[model samples]
Target chain A: MATDRIRDFIRTTRPDGPCLVVDLDVVRDNYRAFERALPDSRIFYAVKANPAPEVLKLLADMGSNFDTASVREIELAMEAGADATRISYGNTIKKERDIARAHALGVSLFAVDSHEEVEKIARAAPGARVFCRVLTSGEGAEWPLSRKFGCVPQMAVDVLVYAHQLGLTSYGVSFHVGSQMTNLDAWDAAIADSKYVFDKLARQGIVLEMVNMGGGFPTRYLKDVPSAEAYGQAIKGALIDHFGNQLPETIIEPGRGMVGNAGAIKAEVVLVSRKSDLGENRWVYLDIGKFGGLAETMDEAIRYPITTDRDADEMEPCIIAGPTCDSADVLYENTPYPLPISLTIGDEVLIGGTGAYTTTYASVAFNGFEPLRSYVI
Target chain B: MATDRIRDFIRTTRPDGPCLVVDLDVVRDNYRAFERALPDSRIFYAVKANPAPEVLKLLADMGSNFDTASVREIELAMEAGADATRISYGNTIKKERDIARAHALGVSLFAVDSHEEVEKIARAAPGARVFCRVLTSGEGAEWPLSRKFGCVPQMAVDVLVYAHQLGLTSYGVSFHVGSQMTNLDAWDAAIADSKYVFDKLARQGIVLEMVNMGGGFPTRYLKDVPSAEAYGQAIKGALIDHFGNQLPETIIEPGRGMVGNAGAIKAEVVLVSRKSDLGENRWVYLDIGKFGGLAETMDEAIRYPITTDRDADEMEPCIIAGPTCDSADVLYENTPYPLPISLTIGDEVLIGGTGAYTTTYASVAFNGFEPLRSYVI
Candidate 1:
């Protein structure tokens, strides 16, 4: 279906300039594959992944619950008609006002790590149901969730006990294996940790009804990356192994893995220059740079650069940079693509897999460039 | 006077939230110092460095010219009461519409890297003066300019001849030594290349009056980093060597070098935690991130962190990160400092020397965080 939608839905939103293209066909398949792999699991689409109202609306329509970390994200999900009972406000909440506001809006569940946060939440929202987030090992993973927020395995039990004393039921146990997790065992290990915590809490008269296995299933960018289906299978098997038939309502939040491959960043090649570094090696330069949004997400040195369909035959190693004066604004280095052709001034080049973070995260607002307009088909 | 004024006049301008504190007195002194070093040279405060109009107005009052790279910057400088005639639209002009706009705005001096750009300028702003940016070696510098824009010394001569035929006056030659240049020889090499280009252009009947040596003088965050005076002196001495007293309207643009040390980014420490990464280490997460600015300007890890005076006694090495969910949103790593003792739930921490690139160029309009509110005292 995704492949079919790609063929049929080449819809154009903006007449000219950068526009975010979302292929719902890809999204529908991504959701279905994730669902089939982990049947009977409650899926909470992390709203932070692609918070575009349209994207959220589609996910909500497909029976995907929302995992909101911030008050604003919860509001956006609510605006899309996501039922209050379906939202999980994971406990890494900072400001007290936000916690109270969430409670006032009838948000029931939360993620709690520290006692300070526990007391603050209890005082603000007394009847709020909560999850004690357990911090798992971040070995082999680039971004570990244990650093800033989350409770240690021992701390999770203590915090759960503390919440019970405060008349709040510990409804679930949540753990994030971290973002862009490529290692399948990382999820397995987190599940193992969650099981240990869940069993301990059960002996203390706390019945865990939910297991929030946070999403880090990386969407394949280049060749060699695992598909979303493979990631979903790994998580499903892990959940089944530990919890068996008595498995709690399962929830997984996949951010980039869900929407990364759905769109491309289209930019115009304003200037191209050739330079021989030492003896006879030449490099081409494009007009866009780090300010174009690729640099901030993928660290500027684009790991995977597939030549656009139009420019595939014109292959040459070119260094692309933003038009901004800053030098670190380089986009790609020594990219192999065809050139010496009429790919001159104002020619368009589409950088792939940029839909997720490129537009939403890093951009230059000072230059009067509006946010890349988004379109959903 | 600078220190006293900073203490008395500078305060966070936002009604309530994270903000930056800029000392106008130090900024003005830095401007005067750079101007004094290059006695005969005109100074253009590179608008791309820190474009806060309050900062611009301070520099404008202290008699600084502007090197604008975009239409927005040009408009900003004009709004700050900078004489439009004293501005030069530097290298990195990508769009043809941008060139046309620059010309229509009365920006006479423009840097042309390609024949296409030259034609665009000729058609758009026919009587424009031009500076053919020559790409020279600054091999070890953090961001080498030649890798992107500029003409080879040999190609530059041809470009000069082309501009001469097009009726656009090729007034001078400009070359950047690169940002954060530690080696004084970079300036030496660029000046030497300028001397060769100046002589070659003179023979072709072009009276080369100005030799613009672009910015990137280092600031005083690290101990051994050279002072602005040393950098200015080195450049001043080189210009005199190349053209003697005949140096035509010598111009220099010192962006980060002047402002980087004078202002600091103050963020509230929302949370602090310790995690074992090979060993146990404390992590300090802030309310701001790369999206807030200071994204990539830092070449290496910054160990120097200033907490609020109240927390001065409590110092520790903490990994500072932004509030964003993205993994790459790290501000500082393995940074050891005394954990400020008095710092509590809502105290601020000062990140020094973030004035230049942080707020000016790199910022993502995500999470609904607003443009940086600036305060100059």
Candidate 2:
């Protein structure tokens, strides 16, 4: 629905180049929807998603906590006038210096998935709250990040236990099913896996006080997906089934699911033509591409819902490419995302569901194309 | 080697964080090597490869022409003191306004892969020197970019003829085998492909003046690639075989090959530990990742040779990861890259062979981690 306004906005404004437009009204609505869906859980907005100044300020004013990944993020959150206590250093892989800097800045909460990080945190900020992350299968998520992060149940238990021994506060267990989690029950396996860690720690007389249901909330895209409310019910069912009557202080960190629907990008079709006589579709080249902002195409893993001036007309499968010198900059080659054959140069393509993981994720100066221009309304 | 100066400089300067140290001396040597190899071709350094001020300044001083992709890059090259006339707006896909602006800025050369672009260039920069790009198989390249660019023989010929009909100057034909291309003979197929376009265009009464050998020049990385001179000799042989001494002015546009080995990066290992008992390799987490920098490790497509303080001793297979919250930040998951087990927190891991695509290809503000800092020596 927001895309309608955004499309018309682009048509009327006619922004000369590719621009990421933010409707603050849509962001507020998404936040309210999430708040209504998960009333009891503390919401920590992942700062990695759309770290625009205005977006941060809006969320902070609305009293949303921040899940920061690095020292710079922690500083940015604080600079946005967010209370230091509202920020958590959420990346498990962290530098010792960043950990120390966060500690010196009065930040207490941190995420750790390994013994090495546990030791680093202990030396940097003893008695700080540290959550151990559990690895999931990362199945059914558009952007599965299973390989880079998380630990097994036994490893998570060991990491938390070791953190306790080293005089750091073992906060709880956290698990991310992966970004853009489509299968609502994807968290079921990880939630059930966390029980092992909780039971083992309780046996050791270290009572866990919290459980972090990490972010994987899917955003609306071209493909069919479960609603956010359905995601809430599925997660609620998992938490209830696992924790039962012993549910701790629950927290949820949402990155894409929060801001994705709030933003839209308008990219002018720089050129449109049939690549070759054998090729059936036209090559639709846009100003914003893999390097120029829209990097989350992730090889079509998370397809962004696209709209154009000729949407009502007949559509043809076109090879969508970014305007870059790199051949790898093709946004969707095999992904049969159809566009209007009538789509021509100077025609604007409004990319919906780009509120998160767009501008901030682009190369600073790839191909000399300017990083995506951002606007907040 | 520039890495040697960078290493000593790091040891002396003691940079506090991840830094891309570029050696201008190495760049000069690389330029001279290419100059010696392709004596007939004008060397247009692909600005997108590094685009560092000092690097551009050095190349410009050595009379290297610049292949610019965007208006910003053209401005950067000019600001770096490169003569504007020596710069070519080489990307086939460009906005009409940008095309006009480049013409306004005194750039007359452009690349075209389709009739649509030819029309745009004709409208924006009438009579500009234009080159038509021919498609290749992209075989034998460490980083293949075949899908996003290039047109087939028929389309390339059509484009050039169309440009001629539209009263614009059709400069020549261009073809890219791929980036970090191995097989020195890979250019042979494309050279043959260009002959058809050349013969067809000549039949249409359009005389071509040049043939651009688009950059795929390999840099020294983990795998051994052909020397720039070898690539030149192979290309020269192919041109002579096909053209039979009727060869026109040849042009070479080198991005990675020119600056890839001229730079190195130093990133501290944030943590080192086993991902899990099931996963065999220890996870070597660096402060930099796909976002912080080092994005060329595309599923181990272009593996950069690595070095560390404990390089001489026993080594074990390790999964290299960036210190980011995104799971996709893992550099080499299944590559079985080995590092000394003694590598621990705070150990500096020098990622050699990273000069070409590291800093210029990272997410600008991902995970709130800072962009890769660059130092020119």
Per residue, candidate 2 scores C-alpha lDDT tens digits across A75-178 of: 88888889889999998888787889999999999999899899999998888999998888888878887566778889888889999999988889998888
The window of 10 residues in a row where model 1 chain A has the poorest summed lDDT is A275-284
lDDT for position A235 in model 1: 78
Question: Model 1, B316-374: lDDT tens per residue?
Answer: 55566776655556666634445664455556667777667666444544543454555
Give DockQ per model, in order: 0.36, 0.79
Candidate 1 positional error at A112, Å: 3.9
lDDT of 2: 0.85
Please give, as one word, the docking class of candidate 2.
medium
Best by lDDT: 2
TM-score, candidate number 1: 0.89
How well docked is model 2, in DockQ terms?
A: 0.79
